[model samples]
Target: MAAIYMRMLGYTVTLTMHGFNMFLMNNLLQGPVMEDPNIRTFSAMYKRFFTVWTMFLQIFVASLGLTSDYLTLKYSNKKEPYWLGVMRSMKNRLFAAILWPTVFLVSTFFWSLYHYDRSLIYPLFADKILSSTANHILHTAVVPLVVWELVFQPRSVPKSHAVNVAMLTVYMSTYFFVMYYTYLEKGVWMYSIFGIAYDTNICFPLIISFIGVMLYIYYHMQWFLTQIVWQPQAKIKM
Candidate 1:
């Protein structure tokens, strides 16, 4: 019951944050900023952001699987084990196992970088782009929601840790390559750090190093959470 409500609350908060982000961008970042070709580009837009993408998927999966939880909570009539039914679909598991970790990983890493240097990670008009409300929801509130799921609805870290890391690498590499080519073509860096002057040789290596460390930490952290949450209570046979 508590977990359900907590998930519901998280969904509500995420939805509200998304709405607030749109309102700010549409209303505040008007005139020239909105009309900037660089900003208007797909890579330069909000959806390109890892934080925004994770939140978007969280809301998307939550809405798509709403009926699963709804039906589970709505009745107690069927009793053949929850896993025996459609509740245990691959989509649900992937969303739970892969998609969920991606969110936490992105959230955790972004916050770490933000703390180290806000200017590098987020720019001057970040508030106008994502809004303070949305930022907190993505960076701060995301922690609690992640902890809530970890504490209550924990899932194991996937055994294919290498595969997971490779997928994440591919994601970052694609972004980097696209942004790199775009910069070559248009003389604009999608991010401040992506410019040829500073980021030429060392930038990618540094980012890759960070990703490797984070992936290692993610596996261990998730393993710990699963241990703490999913351990069976000792039976009292007295």
Candidate 2:
């Protein structure tokens, strides 16, 4: 249910951005009237307004996700049995498994930052490379671990492959929408995969790399769910 709400929120924001972009692009292509200073002033105002508005919206959404994550973790940790007991245990194990890798990634990232040139680092940092990496870790690693434990790890119930694919599609779409707004508003390209400068050839490879990372996280979550959640539940039932 939380996932569904998050997906809707993201989709609505994406559509709003697309609408605004279309309006701007159409007016720009209509050709300027040089004699009309008012028109130019209006255009400038519109651009500034939208830029600030979009930035606020993006920040709001990101903060909401972070808040939601905190709430979810807190609620889950209460052990109120919203889901099956086995599922809860599975989630716990999955969360534990993710901690080590998350620590490793953050440690490596910060260590590399120490050796980076200050001038070079500013652009990269401003482009949200660090924040994006953290966001990706949360989405690809942390969220999945939580979902596996909270949602998927109980009842000996097998879900169809299609269901899994649909859920993933929704998740990725939500993620991409948030990222698009983050870049659009700030004019900062975080990952090379989404960089406008690159041709499809280069961009595609980066996208593949991104996908590979997500898949790795997904499978790892699945393994943890199965081993820690299902196996132990099976043993108890035996």
Candidate 3:
């Protein structure tokens, strides 16, 4: 019983921390960060970026997990509620399928481009609006946080790979469409690479295709990791 309670405490603390960081980041972006003239100028475009979208999603999931944890603890002596289990299962699926992959991909690609040439992915002028701390929390800290969730939490893997794949497909496809739509409306590409090669070269499609493939790779990678961490027969369904 003590061990179980301690585990619950750990999960709650982690979720609270994650949720709080995201809330803080969102607050800064919506308030002080947006106050800057440069940020205000491209606010709509910036909001449409993949990082921001993922950040929002992560925040919501963390909040949901925390809530479910609280309810499960409150009813510790009773039969676990079905809805609570469903909430957790939903959270697990989202984490394994969408959140983990997107966060890893964003952090990896952002830092790679940022190091090679900051101007290409994250230009210097942009630094004034997004401080290094907030920047790292968005692009760097999230990687470990998601990994921590996978390792520490006991979660059932969703049985339907097709459903997971479909969810990811819709998510990436929507963002893909939004990328071109943003260019048409704002006359600016979300990533500079698109602006450079989208019209003349095959690089744009190739990059998008590569990202699509990587998403699936990351998805399966999580399943593999989960299988190693949790019981094979009971936890992992597919």
Candidate 4:
């Protein structure tokens, strides 16, 4: 069965270790490879890709998710309205637990698709810089964890769509702000698609609109999958 600690602890440890290994490999063993003369290895190391940011955030939020789930597991089994029970069984707080880790899982899917042809989006240098194990950890392993939550950890849809939308807006806006700031500071886009969009006028607006529509669709889609399809498996049946 999919348990929160099992799901999140695995993600947290695996990702942290992977990142540590990379840090060691890059800094100590061989040193950072400066692919672009314009971009410093230090800036490029921490502030390179959406995938890296997602990995960091997913690990962070999923740790919180684990704590939320632990509280619920410990307290929700009984009738007392413990604080952890609220985090676990409540509609809105539970949604926050589900949504944040999902922000990265969703990005993982897009990253795989975008990297199909490195020349088109990711570029060839990425392959040399990041090992296949690192790539798979970031791109492939995340999908099953997301699916696990959908199948085993379902929760009823939150009462207010506004709250869900606001949560998503704040999270995604933070990512965009980071992306924009990184670009301004380093003269590079985290992903090639963004750089291409920024260069064109019409495409930029269309891209923004497209992302908004996708966010709406994804939120509802997750709700439908959990609330309708997998509701029976939920620990606190709604």
RMSD of each: 5.3, 13.4, 3.2, 4.4
Clash pairs (backbone) in predicted model 1:
none
* lDDT per residue as tens, model 2, 35-112: 355344333443333222333333343344344444555676575444444453433332333332333333334334
Candidate 3 Cα misplacement greater than 4 A, ranges: 1-38, 156-159, 233-238
Instruction: Name the TM-score of candidate 2.
Output: 0.34
Instruction: Rank candidates, lDDT, best first.
Output: 3, 4, 1, 2
Clashes per prediction?
A: 0, 1, 0, 0
Which candidate number would show the highest lDDT if scored against the true structure?
3
Of the candidates numbered 2 and 3, which has the greater lDDT value?
3
lDDT of 1 by residue, 164-218 (tens): 5565566656756665666678676555544433556777677657666665566
- Report every candidate's CA lDDT: 0.59, 0.41, 0.74, 0.59
Candidate 1 segments whose C-alpha is farther than 4 A from its true place:
31-44, 79-92, 95-97, 154-186, 196-198, 233-238
Q: Sorted on TM-score, highest at the top, how do the candidates line up?
A: 3, 4, 1, 2
Which residue pairs in model 2 clash with each other?
91-149
Off by over 4 Å in 4: 1-45, 70-81, 86-117, 232-238
Worst 10 residues of 2 by lDDT: 120-129
Model 3: lDDT equals 0.74
Report lDDT (Cα) of residue 32, candidate 2: 39
lDDT of 3 at 42: 56
TM-score of each: 0.71, 0.34, 0.84, 0.72
